[model samples]
Target: MDPRARPFRSVLYIPGSKERALEKAKTLPVDAIIFDLEDAVAVEEKPAARSLLTETLKAGGYGPRFKIVRVNGLDTEWGRKDVQAMAFAGADAVLLPKVEKTAQLDELSEMLPGMPLWAMMETPRGILNADALAAHPRLEGFVMGTNDLAKELGCRFRPDRLAMMSSLTHCLLAARAHGVVAVDGVYNAFKDEEGLMAECEQGRDLGFDGKTLIHPAQVPTANAAFAPSEEEIDLARRQIAAFEEAEKNGQGVAVVDGRIVENLHIVTARETLAKAAAIAQLEAST
Candidate 1:
């Protein structure tokens, strides 16, 4: 599938130290997996975890799910080693934590040429520098680290995410402007199914490609929420049909849902179908 057309509905984070979770991921319905080597792994276990992920990735049974390795920042003791190991780990992309500047990406790209990098928008400076970071040629996407953002901002965590709205919107604009994928932050309350679904819906409504997942239970909801709904697909089909029929008579617009649908609307309508088709193709491939 074209990388642009691929869905990022459920980008689940699995701890690299957990062997069982890594194996179980092969059967999950997630669209992507972030093998966490930073926050998720302990200090003593980093070496073993790194070696394990490297070996597992080389062995290869992840199926169609996208595999990404989240590495520590270059300033840390194990950061460079993590990057070196992941350079040949066969993972799809390498995720960098607390990316605050464009130069940081340039440096990482220099270290691992030809490898795609994903940035974690967690710090205040990083959110402010979103434009430059998203504009990088090798950046595949932005993963909102809301947990870190909330901690850094010292703000309350509300279901509406009122405190982080500005930062979220900033990152979203940057990602969309550069045509790079933007995934919403993870919901910390892993057991709150209702909250997770609500947040996924909110993210989808806010133009995010998907929401990050901390657990397997969140996968189905994220996938369903991010994809186009049946009603939306039907409306898109009708809009295209109506618009094409109107154009045959030299008209430039059609009416649907009691509103005017112009040629520009056709572009969106066709894109909706295309997104749905791409998702179906992904499911078929899996």
Candidate 2:
């Protein structure tokens, strides 16, 4: 499936060191899971977590959710080993944190060969060089790291996220320009459903493919926010019908709800229905 078309409405991150969390994730309705061996795993526990996570993945029963293993930087001792294990552990992709350069991707690409790689857009340098990082051949997706970015900028967090829009927008643009999926970062307060929904809606409107989740509670909200609504699906159907009828009648446009519906509108209309259908198919499988 095209990365753009994939239903990544909710990509949950689970700490690899936590067996209970990993097991609990099996029952979640999330679209993707990022099994973390990076910051989520402590310095001393990295090796054990790597081994345990690999074994858990090997005993696979994750079903339809895309499985991603997040590895530490290549400079870290556990990173290469993590990649080696994940390559054969049935993961869909390996995620790299704080990726700022294309060369980092190149090095991993050479090492992993055919593995799909997802980049974490966290550092200022990562956002600045997003185009270059996204342009890497093996790069398939970009996940924003908002907390790290906030720390890097020394900015106060606001519900509106006004301080980070430029960086976020640039990273998103780079991902889209490079034809890769872009997922927004997590909303820190897992218990704050209202806040999470608002952020998910904002991210969807801002052209993100989905949001990276920190908790299972956030999954359904993100999924609902990103998926095409019933109203949108219904309108898309009408628009497509009207446009097709107009085309048959040798007209360049169609009238729907007293508004002009052209080929451009029909294109988006079709996309809406397609996305809705894709979501349905995914849910059915899940």
Candidate 3:
């Protein structure tokens, strides 16, 4: 499957140090998993987490879901060893935290060579240089680190995320400009289903490929929010039918439900149908 066409609606982050969490992930319906070896692990657990995660990844029960391993920063004590261990650990990509520029990705690429790199767009410098980072040859995706970003900017949390709009949209623009997958940051309040759904919908509206989730319960919400709705699918089908009929009649535009449907609308409509098909295939696989 094309990486860009693959559904990434729910990307769950699991602590690398936990055996139970790692095993449970194989059974989860999430579209992707971020096996985290950074903030999720304690200082004492870092080494053990690295070794355990490496072995777990090598074991490879994770089927079609994309596997991304989030490593500690190179500035950290365990980062180098973590990279060396996971270089061939069977993950689909390596996620580096707080990537500020292409040089960081260059350094990581040297260590892992051909590995696909995902950036954590958390810090101010990182957000500002999102274009440069997304343009890196090894970059495959961008994961928003909203908690760290909020702390870095000294911004208060709001349900609507008014303070986060600029940064979120900037990263999204960069990701879209370079054709990389962009995932929204975790919602934090895992227990609030309504809040999670609302945020998921907001992220989807903002053109994020998916929302990073904190817990298993959040998976279904993210998947449902990001997938094309029944109404959208119906409209896409109608639009295509109308547009084709218009073309047969030598017309440049077709009207669907009192609205103009043109070539661009057909393109978007096709993409929606394709996404719905991709989601169905993914669901069937796992």
Candidate 4:
């Protein structure tokens, strides 16, 4: 499947060190799994985590859900070893934490050649250099590390995420510009369904392809938030029909729901339908 066509509605992070978590993840409804060997593992568990995750991936029960391994930064003691282990571990991509520039991606690409790479767009430097990072040919996506970004910025948490808007938008713009999948940061309150839904909606509104989840409970909310709704699907069909009719009539635009439907609108409408179809297919298969 094309990376852009695949559903990323819910991306869950599972600790690579936890065998139980890895096993349970195969049954979840999430669209992607971040088999985390970075912050989620203890210093002493890093090596074990890497080895276990490698074998687990090689075992191959993940199905069509995209599997990405979040490796520790190259500066860390475990980073190089993590990269080497996951290079041929059957992962779809390997994510680098605290990515600040293309050079970091370059080094990772050389170490793990022919694999897709993703970045943790967290630090101030990373946000400022979002465009540069997104431009890397090997980079496939960006996973926002909101917790780390908040700590680095020393900003208070807000439901509106007012302080983080500029950073989020900056990274999002870069992702869209470069055709990289952009996933929103995780919502930490696992038990708060209402809160998780709100953040998922917010992330979707901000043009995120999906939201990273900390818990399995958060998957449904994120999936529903990011997937195209019935109303949207209906409108997309209508817009396409109207635009096609207009084209047959040699008209430059058509009217749908008292709004102008042009070529650009048709482009968006087709994408909406395509995404909806992709989601349906993925759900059926998994």
Question: What TM-score goes with each of the models?
Answer: 0.98, 0.98, 0.98, 0.98
lDDT of 3 by residue, 1-286 (tens): 2357899999999999999999999999999999999999999999999999999999999999999999999999898998999888999999999999899899999999888889999999999999999888889899999999999999999999999999999999999998999999999889999999999999999899999999999999999999999999999999999999999999999999999999999999999999999999999999
Q: Write the per-residue lDDT of candidate 4 for residues 198-278, one digit (tens) a residue.
A: 989999999999999999989989999999999999999999999999999999999998999999999999999999999
Note the Cα lDDT for every prediction shown: 0.92, 0.92, 0.95, 0.94
**lDDT tens digits, residue span 92-162, model 2:** 99999989899899988987888899999999999999999888889999999999999999999998999
Pairs clashing in candidate 4? none
TM-score attained by model 4:
0.98
Candidate 1 residue-wise lDDT, 168-256, digit = tens = 99999999988888999998888998998999999999999998999998898899999999999999999999999999999988898
lDDT comparing candidate 3 with the true structure = 0.95
Can you tell me which runs of candidate 1 are displaced by over 4 Å?
A: 1-3
Error of 2 at 280 (Å): 0.9
RMSD, one per candidate, in order: 1.1, 1.0, 0.9, 0.9
Error of 1 at 245 (Å): 1.0
